[model samples]
Target: MFLTRAPFRALSRQFQQSVRCLCDKKDKDVKTTVWPPENKEKRLEDWKVIDSTELKPPPAENPITRTHRILKDDILRLKKYIPGLDGRTTRQNATMWKHTLFGEGEGFPEEEFFPSHCDIVIIGGGAIGSSIAYYLKERAREGLRVVVLEQDKTYEKASTTLSVGGLRQQFSLEENILMSLYASDFLRNIKHYLGDHVNVNFVPHGYLFLATEEGAEQLTQNSTLQNRLGAKNILLTPKKLKDRFPWLNVNDIALGCFGLEKEGWFDPWSLLMGFKHKAQSLGAEYIDGEAVNFEFEQNEHIQIQGVPSGEYNSTNNLIVKLNTGEVKRITFATCIVAAGAWSGHLAKLLKIGSGPGILSVPLPVEPRKRYVYTIKSQGQNQPLFNSPLTIDPKSTTYFRCDGLGGNFLCGRSPSLEDEPSTENLDVDYSYFDEMIWPHLAHRVPAFENAKVCSAWSGYYEFNTFDENGIVGLHPYYHNIYFATGFSGHGIQQSPAVGRAISEMILHGEFTTLDLSRLGFDRLMVAEPMLEQNIV
Candidate 1:
């Protein structure tokens, strides 16, 4: 059974000093029930449950400023478990977690009868939702509370979890490129403050983009902008790209650029968990409920009540509820709608057309179906695990290794007409045979003869406008904030989006970066940031 090591105690003490991290046990008597089987037989007291806000006493001798690397490494090695882990994804993610500050937990705790409520209510616990919770919790006060309301417990349909999980800076606008650049840095050093428990892997495998004639012109221009902003990894020639990714066929008559070091994918949920665990430890709450509708209390809040009130008068409050015959009232002083595809569906209640209000932009971020197929490699020589995250910008398709034997591959919908209905949540494999396979074959001939592998389908928060996200405040709903319309890039954008949303609510304006450009005012002027790198 896994026992608390010396490093965990040191880490727990560190978190405790930063904020008052409390475990919500009834009687201050913690019980041991659902501890990971790996940690079986150990008593909860022996497990070292330290308050998150508590910190370790400083060492008297050689002073360590922050983020001690070795002790941090040990914290990650201890909390290792994967339920329903697809064989190809388990090891890489866990290993990545060991080095990176990728967050943990499957969105919801598996333990039963959990409570949920907080002063700030965030809808949609995907990347953006959870990220907002992180910032909100990070700046918590004595009694000021924050909570996240998520629909799916397993995140089977979260756009953040389902998307390609890519982050790049090849944007036509300087703001977009710079924001992503800062986000990349934030991702790299997440474990420094969030938790030493996990390293949170953000592999610098690099991003490859191909250019058709028009796309080439766009890439050439954006590459200059990316470079001016210090995105040093931009590639201008096809030869350079071909040399970097030998597997890529760059015969097309245009240009190509790769974010040589600044762009790549990472462990999304671990990032989610890193924020979530720290947030919870610092007194942020998470509720597993589908935020179906809202009550616009004029300038105040949407009410939430029921779901077994907490004895602490402020614990276990579920903000979102299915459309049951009964009505429960839960209120939030400030409410942020980070709901992805479902944001539009929920916003229909107030008829608030997507203008600006954080992640909710005029972006046509509607749900569209996409399929992911898994392909086993030829052998160890062609190991999928070592393969980098590859994208064929020509058709907006990409493939990357899940872990060992197979790769997780997907591409955009053939056309808006071919997209699945918003009501449909089922996986469609036919899209692969009719559209995806042919396009994949053209990009990587190795895949041309590659046999069909098992496939699954999920939704894309299709940004109907330019492929960029819709963030910031709405024109009419000043008090209400929304975080929808990420198109397919929400996961990478979640961390930044979360912090921005929190800053907007508590401080009245974004201090980190001015998100005013992403607001509803843009829609009023009919000016939108059209992203060229949508895949």
Candidate 2:
């Protein structure tokens, strides 16, 4: 019965094809054509109907189309073995299209399935972590898989969002100076890297660091170093400072280091979003979860310099707790601890500080709460629109104009003895009135009558050792790396730090900047990369 039905099925299909052709011909014949009678060949060619069974040579495939076909075939093959692979790929493609057609929306739809494994896993999804993801995926494209685990998607307490968005190249250390210079370049040409729709709202007024008579020599030396390293800045006398900024009171000031170019503040939130959107568009997966713990495997084959012969344990899996309260494990070949202020705590999960030998040295990064207050000084002698972000070395107070209104943002990092509790993000208005107002009013007499309008507090990924970023592999776990301990300059240095981390991961060494001095090895050697300009 099957053999008899085979020929009948073929004949039925042929009959249907013939009927379809006839109906199509009749429909075409009834439609009126605008072509002249002389263009008979063109009309026939335009309305030609080929046979269903006829074989025609395929058209030439462009590079883009060929690449897409290869990717589609690979996805199709993997879909059978990998659950939800096809759906994830489709959603990612849709997200790319959405971002390209209409600028970034709320975000890509929340992913339903968490990835079981990835090539690289970043602990934080703030500016630093997102920037690292962006650089890695951008360089490796589909060849690399990067997953960023962020505890909070809203970024309410993220330091990158709450920062004052200051960018300056005035630093005593060469590494910090170079990083700031590169950040300025990166932000200036941000449209080339992160789509044209992304705007940071950069305000290029520059930074002014005031110094007392006791700190004048150190300030001059810093200014000299900054100028020698391609930073456009000038060492201004108190008379020159008063001339440039009429609102400033330079009575107690001995010297002022003023940035002439490539220094300013931009919208940190926008910059963070740009990095995140660009990273996601480049195939980086951002998981909404916190890294609760780490799982280690005892590997007999692996050996470290200081670790005992048989006691070496390798860590490649992270236990994460999702926002929905589901705990899962994600295995990765490499892990980067860019968790900002929380990096030290995350490191402790892996026995970084508790373990014997080199692991006993803890990651000194921790959250230091600093308050920022916005004040309005409406009366006479208000700071001009172009007033630089001014810092007083004596009191550690800094203030910068906030847009066109008669408003300014001022803050002072509390002394170590007077450090506030990091239990919450509550703003202490009294700290600003007592510690900050006295310094700000003394620096700029216009702020003497300023009334506090609003206040906020954020964590500075403070490094207790030297207050500088630690960017390198861990001493014990070769697979783990760190890009934390940036003190208060992480956001501005994120672009350079991300590229540096990617370089080290992909190329196995520092490529662009020789940040060897700023590595975890420094902690082991008891040598700190101290920067004279901490603010």
Candidate 3:
């Protein structure tokens, strides 16, 4: 079978060409000579013709019109859930609902209409109050009606807006530490909870606490506890302190505790607005008004062991005075007092201190005016951009870089005997010159040339009793709860406090953080959950 190479190759090529020619002839015959040859033209035309109708694009839809259509459809779908809704009023109600959710045109009121009754009434529409509203509505959605009453919508004197917006986990108490930890996490993932458009502008700068020999032991203890509870901080000696912060005067400093992470400052106003907008979007109502008084009724059926059978006053209605000089009463199933500095006053309206037994103890939360001064230092070897929100524990003076422009914010809490008047939010510039400047100059010699560019004052919801937040239900009133008395930490702890309040209301217990020790029950027992690291 082995033929010569050239002859074999020539023969194989001839055979392959003959097979390919036969296959091509068979395919041509099958393609041209189908069973129904008469309809060949129709079959060929069908293959060639494309349906232009199917290829045509759909008409463009206006975004506004599409939004209206979607809203209308949603209204119709939700109409069934509303009992006693008739066909005649469906369109009108739907239009109102659309305007309420989306936007208001002329003749449509921008203010939230007063409701006669709601599930919960929150007194004070600051960051803490708004947060409670947000968390409640977020959990219950339309199933819950939450109303927040604020005296000032502008928030000119609001403690939340006026705060320096510092967030740190350096604390002596476990509750405060845990709350701050959650706050850092909440602010970090704020977009997931509040919306993608919301930003808190969190600046991740650590807080440096400088302690004298007298306070060195306490500082070390606090640092140890803070680190044990997932907080990252380091204790540095005098030499290390000077090395880390060369501009700092550590000649008298015995120890220094510096936070490594989850400690910083943010825009308090932004956070407050974020809570407010999200809460409103989730069906919480914010009314521009002041909580003037409470209407209480004695319930004979309900009895408490400490109170007489018929003397138990149950608070279910709140009288609010609107910004327009109109007063209205709102009945609520449960009420929360988060009035910040004014919480103590609101508690008085409920006869908290005037009443008998457990109500004798007031909220102990009052307004303590604190001043913040912004200074600019152009001296040589001034604190750099990396400088933290530094604190001198002995002097109770603290300062932090305001921006990259060599501006710094400095303040000090007044001595107990030298507390200033809180009649107005007036900043006393003399305070900085007499009380704060000397300490600042000593801490950083370069601060001697710093000039006060501006200054402002804010009221701390100072808890006179323990200087801690008064949370949970009041012993006298079963339906009343408190999320106030945070002193100066309310802005940072608003998220955790709101969630804790919501958990208490919705689940009848704290499901996440056990803040029982911070409850009003502690006030009755006269045990204060005091935190040593207070600025």
Candidate 4:
């Protein structure tokens, strides 16, 4: 049979056309179903007949053609539309998109390095880092200049690239919900700010969290908190859930909260690129360099050497040096660390806001590894174009339909103890089959029949202490600040947190939404705002 890869609407339209043609032919031997010939003709008659040959398999396809034809054409047309980067042929651009789906290609020519500078420096070019860069540039147009330091120009290894890309307002904390709301709004208008050149194919299908008896009480409480914030997602009783999702098996579920709106997954890398492109266009510079250490000067009014603080440093003169065999020096007036997992180490070195700047900075922000497995299942054989994301609280196994028939990407968190080495990102298969599969089978019996086809691993910057985000200025240092330890929800909250961080860096305070709840002071006070929605 033909593999169900084509767009549903398009294929449906084609089938309808053929059916109408066949029905119109002047033949009289007609066989029909429950409805009579007249009823069938009056109904959606065009769908009554389908070509027998269409049921057969499609001819063998090539590994390197067809679908790429349109992609290549678009790349060629959009090249001159974007500036800054040297002219790249369509073939080169095609390879880039291919690398996005598969492995990276041969390295490109290392261009002659240009010595550039900025007033404020941010380390990292992924979601958190790029957001800080963009917001600062937008807010501090007159006096603030920003530079984003990225170790990998493509950000292939960043958690932003490997995220499940889910967004929700079902968080237990008010600030967390508000921050995500800000991001949702920004994402809705992303094309406007980033440009029509960028398009994030965001599907607003909601998420359903099935609460188990073990966690039902806390989850229901969380739902109450979420609902109080005007998020209409209600906690469904087993009966109510059955009424809404009759197709689902809710025998094992206790209380379930379904985010019927304002939640879903999207292409993570696209969102990152959108921000980066706009930031670059607005004069923010993104350079390649991992921040191994920081240079800070201690005094009544402290100043970090490489970073510039418009208040203390010369205007338009920003630079930082990369730690290489040859000392590469770059100086910036101010510095913001958005280096995800590495933020902990960077903060330790600067002695700025360690453990929230005073009482104690016991941030349980540790790097943990997890695996993502995409599998083919006999259960969901049809193209899952409209399935909602289902989270089983009992098993902690999340399931969603694959765009392609008979397949979906699924995985689970590894306990902190058994996780991969913070530095080794290598993928392990046994972890999935042994740890994830048993739990998955318990929640969704349908998944019991699934088999893993492909898998990958990435890092989660776990906020171990309270599993909450840490935002705002570094307590000890003046110009140095941070927005890290978001745990896994970084991408969803990056938009608002980024704007908040940028506003703080430029104007010395929060202008829009108040972010006092996520400040670094939590560590010192020994009071952390914990959220219960962590997966």
Error (Å) of candidate 2 at residue 504 is 0.4
The parts of candidate 3 lying over 4 Å away from their true place are 1-112
Q: What C-alpha RMSD separates each model from the true structure?
A: 13.9, 18.8, 26.3, 22.5
Clashing pairs in 2: none
Ranking by TM-score: 2, 3, 4, 1
lDDT of 3 at 301: 78
Q: lDDT: which is higher, 2 or 4?
A: 2
lDDT of 3 by residue, 395-500 (tens): 8899999988889999988889979988777789999999999999989999998899999998999999989999999887889999999989999999999999
Candidate 2 per-residue lDDT over residues 333-394, each given as its tens digit: 89999999888888888788889898899999888898999999965776898989988888
Per-residue lDDT tens digits for candidate 1, residues 301-363, read 322232122211111122244222122334455567777876655555444553223323333
Reference-based TM-score, model 1: 0.70
lDDT of 4 by residue, 1-535 (tens): 1111112222333333234324322321112212222222111112122221222223433423423443454355344323335476667655654443222454232222322334677877889888887776666543445667786666767889988888888778898888877777788888777767567777787778887688799888877887777666778899998787654667878888888767888888988987776675455656665554443332434454444453232121222333231223344557777878766656555543342224135445666777788887676422254766777675567767656566777777666666666556778888878888887666556677878888777677787778777888755455667778888899999898888887786677999888887887777677878777767
lDDT of 1: 0.58
Comparing 2 and 3 by lDDT, which wins?
Answer: 3
How does each model score on TM-score?
0.70, 0.82, 0.81, 0.73
Task: For residue 72, give model 3's deviation from the true position in Å.
Answer: 17
Task: For candidate 2, give the lDDT.
Answer: 0.79
Q: Candidate 2, which segments miss by more than 4 Å at Cα?
A: 1-96, 99-108
Tell me model 4's lDDT, rounded to 2 decimals.
0.64
State which candidate, 3 or 4, has the greater lDDT. 3
